[model samples]
Target: MLCIEDLLTLELFKTLPRNRLDWICDRSQILNLSTDEILVSEGDPARGFFIMLSGRMGLTRRSDGMEMPIGQHEAPSFFGEIPILTGDPNPVTVRALTDCHLYQLSSEDFLTLLHECRNFEQVIFKTVAKRSRGLESFIRNREKMAALGTLAAGLAHELNNPAAALVRALRDITPALLELQRMNLVYGQHQVDAEHTAQWIKARDEGYETITHKRIDPMKLSDREDELLDWLEDYGVEDAWKLAGPLAEGGTAIATLEELTARWQDDQTKMGTMGLRWLALSFEVMSMISSGLRGAERIAELVQSMKSYSHLDQGARQLVDIHEGLEDTLRLFSYKIKNGVEIRRSYSPDIPKIWAYGSELNQVWTNLIDNAIDAMNEKGILEIVTTPYSDRIEVQITDSGSGIPQEIKSRIFEPFFTTKAVGKGSGLGLEVVRRIVEIRHQGSITVDSQPGKTQFTICLPIG
Candidate 1:
């Protein structure tokens, strides 16, 4: 049923000699496939070269038991050549999308033609090159999307705690302000003596300063709170425990409270009520202000870290502090490391900044540090050490995780080579690191691994 006229339509056969075309047609068998029929399953052994004669076929790749359509083969197109040439299992499943007619050439016959026909070999190799580039381009973009997704997830998690703290601080400060205003009106009405009122204001200001500038020891604070509670209760103050916490946090001494209460000793009701309430409320306002300030600072710090990691407001290539970049990445990934990972940094203060692609260089650090976290499973020590080498700055990132296997170490930097499970890795992370460090920055990266320690060392020129 097949004719040389059908072969003429294919660019591959059109360029081949008449005798060779006849030879290929004779050696190949025709296969008719109905819609939805599978021609070859992924991981199946290579059977032959398939040249599509009519209808369309689709190719789907399986990743983690999920099938994803990657490409298609229409009439006059050919496949199975890559697997045949490499002698590997098929990388994707091929199925007919419509009723299809295909010419299947046995592997032996295909190789014989490859060896004997110069034009045929050239055309096949060209197709291989073009197809390889297309696949790589598609996969590289997917790898970037995957990496961005991971970093976005980590960033969201890292931002949550501080953002929540900021919200809570803002919410609590409002009610405290209203309570302070009510206390101000009451103080004017009570009209205590000027001298004693000045003393109370002085004491309140001092307590505010202590809350703002001093750090309290937890154990000491606990002891002081108990003492204050006992004294307040003995003096007939109701809810004595309510005033203990802020007073203790403000580092208020028992003697100071006693002296402040001396004026109101005869008026026990006032001393136990207004005097105690005023002092506690003053300390509470100061504490809320401090908490709010700290929450805002933390939010700002995270935002600044993200900006630095991205090299915002800067050109692509610039003089970069490698240590700063590493720190920024660590800050961005703190959510992942803070719980169990201990990070130790050793830096050579004299090492100079390097001229390089700033953000891309940061990407190298991100990938290396992220990989280290994964290797340790978030529970080991990670060390970052920088020192001056011969006219270069050397950064060594070492992790206390199970080391890379000797056999696979050499291939770890190869694109599409991964130890991670399918769907978890696009396998381009280390390859991108390699390209950025070596090709883009003209730097060198090397790995040293053993049973419990694995180190990735990068040396960049001081330019």
Candidate 2:
């Protein structure tokens, strides 16, 4: 049983004249909702209009298998008008926050009131517009945050390997250096002849040069190490096996070790053999230091790429080299692609810089490249082609994965539409790409696909 008095209590109904209010009360149905009850579900057919009478209701939209509250409705508030006006399904699920009373107007009656009352129509439509704008704003921000989270996770994973190498290098180098120093001090106390010392120094320097400058064949080095191991054991050098790897890596032949240890063999003490051991260990330490430096340099390079990709220290809009941005994004995503994906680049060497939002352009590249990697299931060839057009530059990213199906291609850029599994996508990736390319950079993006290949082309004006 619906009453005129209850209808008048709602702000939207208050604006309607007495006759219209009476008409609405007669056509409307009274609905009572218990706590946690569902009012309308997302994607459900637009049934009618609702005006809350008492208690509260919460609106939520599904993303990544979770219900995310996007808006709410309380007593005297109205909803369901948006879907009715647009003739579309409900965009959000509405559930009761508390036991509630509401008035539901049929689509026919809701339309009649919309047409017949000027003030009532104005208020309802305005509220619809305001709510729509607010929802859009909220979702847009959420999209950016989600994208940032994805990028951040990818960046952390990519940085970890090189960073760990750098740490291990630093940790191991100190002890090796100290051990080498102790060996040097022991040798220095002995009154060794200058000529013998010179011979030892020359041999040590040559081994270091060979190890640092020349790459040894692993098979040949293994044979050489075996020969040296047997020779050192026969000559009575303690733990001869321990010196074999370093001496082999340092290009120390059995002849070289035999000649270097000749003087110590006659001595009752094994100082000469000890010196040879120290020299091989020293060469090994040098190799470690070299590798550590390389790891540190790699870490520095990745950090710089991350900074450039984000344009953290740069202005919002600037003249940017498109290839630079693309490369930076590739570097950040390298961890994901490194296992099996092969990247091919074809850049027109002279492509000009373009004025744009540098970071946004990077985001565009990130999304497209990331999507391509996923499309390939992380094990196909990805090609980036850049061509200079008249007053613009065209960049294409192509992946050797099964192309997007024709039926869904047209709707791919629609917000919250995705082919990815639940919990793996928010469905805003391509929408963000479209907004950045078309709205932020004044560019055009187009895609072409087939069974084996899909290419996304972005054209940006040079001016």
Candidate 3:
């Protein structure tokens, strides 16, 4: 238990009226944390404030996905009071810097404490307001550095493309290098005459092109080289080397090219199974480039969506189609959905659009759809239906799979409480969805869950 009087010595709790202080003292619970335990994470819903009782805690900001410590709080300082006041997700993650004890008052309990203790509420709000302003300023400065993240996801593709080409170019070198080694080995061992070896080299050189192209007509190639050599002799050329430059030095380069081109003029399939393999690798590289571009494009689009969805560009809200927002959002998630799911839409063809922050509402759709897809375990049917009411448009996203567990449904929208395996989810999604719906669109969201089905509903008021 945390007594208001005991915490009052802390600057953050000092201003509460004695009665108000006692009210807070009555509701707070004490929790113990082991070293390295996570207290709060970035984007987690702010449940209430925490006062570190007897150990160190770290505030970590996730930038470039590196959890750099932004600050540290020692015993007697409170945290999370800022986001609780502003209704935004907690932007910093707080983890135990050492084995520690903490006093926690959940947001639900805080409401009752707040109603009973105006003085305590005022102290918390005043302290958090100053912190909020500072955080806002920090956020603006950090936003600039975020461009590096954008460039990284974008420009990193430059490396992937060249890296993929190198993989192919290396594959082609294997046989050629081996053949060269065999040549030197045989000749160095005195196994053949220089003239015989030169002829063998010439034949091997011709075969390099033929077999690579899998043409392999040894006699035909020998006869063609002979015919070409004979023609050069008719023009008073003797040495094959002496005639080489003149043949190529004149327009005969084009004639040789024409001869080679005629041989290779067969369709790509003429290389038989070998050609199919080469084509497969070539297409694979092309696919890597395409997928990388798509990933980079998606990151850029998310930044755009983030900027537009907030629409700080212009302050006033206006009429927008929720489905249009959902449709565009769906495009961004095409890869995730297309991998293993069937989507069904039963939208009312004529529902009126609602007035709200269009992009923010799109996030609501995105978050819901993301959860619905996850609920299906990435495989099953997803159904979306739009219905018009007297004053609101109701949208339902449903999935066929295991549903939310009953024991934890009440806390599903609470921040940091996710059933997802570590690293895959942060548990902030539904909480963000709740805020976007209630705060931005003045809408309502609810969920109905069962063993093989889970449906999330969104109702946005019409203008």
Model 1 steric clash pairs: none
TM-scores of the models, in the given order? Answer: 0.89, 0.89, 0.46
Per-residue CA lDDT of model 1 for 200-254, tens digit only, reads 7888888888889877888988999999899889877889899988888877887
lDDT of each structure?
A: 0.84, 0.84, 0.63
* Cα error of candidate 1 at position 84, Å: 4.0
Candidate 2, position 248, lDDT: 86
Per-residue CA lDDT of model 2 for 1-463, tens digit only, reads: 6777877776777777788777777887889999999988877889788878799999887765778898889887777888888775677889999999988988878888888889988998889889987876776777667667777888788767767777886888898888888988888899788998888888888888887788579999999889888988888878888888888888887777778787678887779778878887888877777677777788788888988988888889888989999999898888889999999999999899889999889889988998899899999999999999788899999999999999999988986666765445656788888988899878899999997799999999888
Assess candidate 1 and give its TM-score to the true structure: 0.89
1 or 3, which is superior by TM-score?
1
RMSD of 2: 2.8
Where is model 1 more than 4 Å wrong at Cα?
A: 1-4, 26-48, 55-71, 86-109, 266-272
Off by over 4 Å in 2: 15-19, 41-48, 63-66, 83-90, 106-125, 210-213, 217-221, 421-424
